[model samples]
Target: MQCHQTSFTLSTAGRGPLRLTARVAECVRDSGIHTGLCHVFCQHTSASLLITENADPAVLRDLEGHLTRAVPDGDPRYTHDQEGPDDMSAHIRSILTGSGLTVPIRQGRLALGTWQGLFLWEHRAQGHARTLVVTCFGTAAS
Candidate 1:
C-alpha cells in the first residue's frame, strides 16, 4: 500500500462554492496513485466540502440560495457575533455541511459521475485563502 499527500490554497471571492475537481485531479495524478481512495478536506471551521452538480451553474446558485435561507445571517439570535453577522452563520453553515469528501480513484482518474464535481464551500462573507488537503491511499502496482 502507498500513501501520498498534497495540499493547495484557493483564494475565494466571498461566500460561494468553488469548484476544485480539476485541482484535486491534478494532485492525484501527481501522486502516482493509480487506483485508490482520495480524501479531500478543507482545513477551516467556517468552510465545508461538497460533491455537487457540475453541469449547471444554476444548481450551485440554488444551493447557495437554499443555504442562505436555511441559515440566514444577522439572525440576532446567535450569541457568537464577535466577527459580525456573517461570523456565527458561517460556522453554522459549516456544521450543517462538512469539511471533508472521499472519492474513489480508478485508472488514475476520479470515479465520479459526469455531472458530479467536488467543491469547497466558503461560507464567509469576505475573500480569503483556503487550504485544501488531498490524501491518496491505495496499493501501488507491483
Candidate 2:
C-alpha cells in the first residue's frame, strides 16, 4: 500500500466558493496511490469544504445565496462578534456545511463525477488565508 499527505493554502478574496478541483487533483496525482480514499480538510472554523456541481456557475451561486440568507450577518443576537458581524455567522455556515471531505482516488486521480468539483467556501466578509490538508493512502499503481 502507498500513502501520501500534503497541505496547501488558499488566499480568498471574500465570501464565495473557490473551486479547488484541479489543485486537489494535482495532489492525488502526486500521491501515487492508485486506489484509495483522499481526505481533504480545512483547518479553519469559519471556512469549509464542499463537493458540488461544476457544470454551471449558478449552482454554486445559489448554494452561497441560500446559506447567506439562512444565516444573515449583523443579527445582533450573536454576542461573539469581536471579529465583526460575520464572525459567528461564519462559524454557523461552516457548521451547516462541513470542515472536510473524503473522495475516492482511482487511477491516481480523484474519482469525482463529470460535473463534480471541490470547493473552499469562505464565509467571512474579509479575505484570509485558508489552509487545506489532503491525505491519500492506497495501493500503488501496477
Q: Which candidate number maximizes lDDT?
A: 2
- What residue pairs clash in candidate 2, if any at all? none
Top of the candidates by TM-score? 2
| Candidate 1, RMSD to the unseen true structure | 0.9
Prediction 2 global C-alpha lDDT: 0.94
lDDT (10s digit) by residue, model 2, range 1-142: 8789999999999999999999999999888899999999999999999999998999998998899899999888888999999999999999989999999988888999998999999999999999999999998888
In order, the Cα lDDT scores of the candidates are 0.92, 0.94
Give RMSD to native, each candidate. 0.9, 0.7
- Per-model TM values vs. the true structure: 0.97, 0.97
| lDDT score, candidate 1, position 80 | 95
TM-score quality measure for candidate 2: 0.97
